[model samples]
Target: MLPYACAWIAKSKGFGKPRREGGFDNHDPRAWLSRLTDWQARANAAQANSFEALPFFIGAVIIAHQLAAQQAVLDILALLFVTLRVIYIAMYVAGLPTVRSAIWALALLVNVGILFLGWR
Candidate 1:
């Protein structure tokens, strides 16, 4: 949800029209977004990553519930996942690829851990 919102914001922020054109041009908004540089591009990338990560996270939670994993552990891990994702977004926007990658790796690990717990 947040990722989709970010994508919308990124599109809105990157929107523009050629000065010689009429009221609105027929150019694709995504094409405009793709041309964005710097932080805006990074925000767009982050939005993409957010969507990519959602499925694994959701699957992990559902599997954990189905396997009857401890509620407390699931709760804590879910919180940690959200926290790490928020930080990951910040790192992405700030142009800290190393830190952002580390956070992304951590989030993936958390998801894998949840799945493993469920399997056990």
Candidate 2:
């Protein structure tokens, strides 16, 4: 959702691909947050990679919990993970560095929670 939103923002801001070119424009928050500089490109790329990881991270947590024979907690953890990730992405786009960091920490906690919660 964050990645898609960023792409939309990029297109809306005219930072994304020109209709003539096959390449896309950068609609990511990093693109704008980079002060319209080259770093914007790097940031966009990094965000893209991170977004890709999100699903796998959630999936892995679910699988781990399931393998531990804890289906109920896995369901709860999946919801929490998605919720945290949404907040994290919102913080990133809003340029709230501390809040974003906190959100990330929360996400890590959720991952750990899935493991620990399943153990009991």
Give TM per candidate.
Answer: 0.83, 0.60
- Cα lDDT tens digits for candidate 2, 1-120: 656665554344444456345234344534444444343343354367458757767667766766684677677886888788777766666667798789888887887766566554
lDDT of each: 0.80, 0.62
* Candidate 2 total steric clashes: 4
Alpha carbon deviation, residue 42, candidate 2 (Å): 10
Worst 10 residues of 1 by lDDT: 17-26
**Index of the highest-lDDT prediction:** 1
Which stretch of 10 consecutive residues in model 2 shows the poorest summed lDDT?
A: 37-46
For model 2, the stretches where C-alpha displacement exceeds 4 angstroms are: 15-46, 55-59, 115-120
